[model samples]
Target: MNNSLKTIAFISGIVILAYGVYTLFKPETQISIGDVDLIETQDNTNSYITIAVGIVIVALSSIIGKK
Candidate 1:
């Protein structure tokens, strides 16, 4: 990994983490796709996933570029 990559990862991680927290607290949304309607909701499983991914990205930014 390089400094640029680490920077990108760090920024991306922050964005993902922020969005994850935001969505976790926000209400669900209803959407229709090709006549199939779906209601989106956040659960613990998803919360964990986003949090994990974000943490992994941030950790990678710290660990990957240097010793």
Candidate 2:
């Protein structure tokens, strides 16, 4: 049903949004040696895109079946 689809979309959007936010703050890679530590910084481009997509999905779900 349309309602079920909307519910699924809403949940998926929240999940995606959470994932995007998590990745945005999460470190990409890390390495540790005897006296040296290295960390790779994350590129926010993907996270931003994911967040945008999630927002769009959530918005669409809210408008589904509306006149």
lDDT for each residue of candidate 1 in 8-62, tens digit (9 for 90 to 100)? 9999998888877876778778898998999975576787689789988899889
Identify the candidate with maximal TM-score: 2
lDDT of model 1 at residue 23?
Answer: 66
Q: List runs of model 1 lying over 4 Å from the truth.
A: 28-42
Cα-based lDDT at residue 62, candidate 2: 96
List the pairs of residues colliding in candidate 2: none
Off by over 4 Å in 2: 32-37
Give the alpha-carbon lDDT of every model. Answer: 0.83, 0.92
Question: Candidate 1: RMSD over Cα atoms?
Answer: 6.2
> What is the lDDT for 67 in model 1?
75
